[model samples]
Target: MSDLVDKAKNFVAEKIANIKKPEATVTDVDFKNLSRDSVTFNAKVSVSNPYSTSIPICEISYTLKSATRMIASGTIPDPGSLPGNVTTVLDVPVKTPYTILVSLARDIGADWDIDYELDLGFTFDLPIIGDITLPLSTKGEIKLPTISDFF
Candidate 1:
């Protein structure tokens, strides 16, 4: 009886391992806007769903870190849905206060840009598999917007 149960478990595990899941990638991160109190950066994420039906996104959680400091972290609830059988690009806006940016002046002094690591989680429900979170991360430099850009 023990041998049969072990064989059944192995078979189930193998099937689960072979299941196809949605693929996601962080395409780009760029400066989006500059407000009076904060700066906004947009992280572009591309998610390709393998299923034929659109999957509703439960939440999009993000963390922006630079110079070992967590600049911003938040969750966007019920943003939208991922299109089926295609790659969908979603923009996650990360807002950081001017005070935090001021603290990292040394890193910005070299090139007037922020070297950041952005972590994003794309949460969606899959058929028969429950909720699956596709994690995507990207490291890059975002050139700061100059005062001249506004003018």
Candidate 2:
């Protein structure tokens, strides 16, 4: 009986390790030139699951923090499943020196972290059974040219 329990625990851990977390990034940051009342910036986040089993429904958290304060935070309901990938867009006011943090719980013991780049781009690879890091880099943040003059 004890051996069976240990085996079960190991199995569960292996599965949990296989679950992949979504990669959150700012795909596009468009600064609209208007009255400057409140400029809306659009950002995109992508999530992918590579496990054979379907991921359970859970809440996804996205947070944008600056050096001194948190710029924005939001949550979205995700019924994530295996071999599943999704992209979500968010609109936020303009703020400088911001970092985005995206996280989600895969299961009771499994969770995910968003990989980011210095240029405001990122990619996430799902965990698999044998290979810890999957070769797939399905999601990527596209860069847009910076506009010097916005009149």
Candidate 3:
């Protein structure tokens, strides 16, 4: 009886390990718009689903940081669903207030850009696997618009 139980455990473990899962990647981040109080940026995420049925996205949460300081963070509820057996791209919007940007003037002043790290979480429900969270992170510098660009 003990041998049979051990064999069953090994089989189940192997099956779980061999199962294929969906993959996601952050493609790009771009400036979207500038308002009186805040500047908005959009991060593009591409997810490839291998299943035959579409997976519903519970939420897309994001946090944008600069120099170890959190500049912006928010959650997009009920964003949408990922198409089955296809790569789907979604946009996550992040807004930073002018006051927060001003505090990072030292970094921006040096290179006319801001170094940032973006963390994103994608929550989805699989067929029988229950809930799964795909976390992605990227770091880069964003060039701030010059005075001439505003003109």
- Candidate with maximal lDDT: 1
Q: In model 2, which range of ten residues has the least summed lDDT? A: 100-109
CA RMSD for every model? 1.3, 13.0, 1.5
Q: Candidate 1 at residue 23, lDDT?
A: 88
Candidate lDDT values, in order: 0.91, 0.37, 0.90
Which tens-of-lDDT digit does each residue in 73-114 have in candidate 1?
Answer: 999999988887989988899999999999999999999999
lDDT of 2 by residue, 1-151 (tens): 9999999999999878565554444444443333334323344434344334444434434444323234454544542433454444433333322222212112211222222221232222233433222121122222222445433
Determine which window of 10 residues in candidate 3 has minimal summed lDDT. 125-134
Lowest summed lDDT window (length 10), candidate 1:
121-130
**How well does candidate 2 score on lDDT at residue 73?**
48
lDDT tens digits by residue: candidate 3, 10-103: 9998988787888988898877789999999989999999988889999989999999999999999998898889999898999989999999
User: Residue-pair clashes per candidate, as listed?
Assistant: 0, 0, 0
lDDT of 2: 0.37
Q: TM per model?
A: 0.93, 0.39, 0.91
Candidate 1's C-alpha runs over 4 A off are none
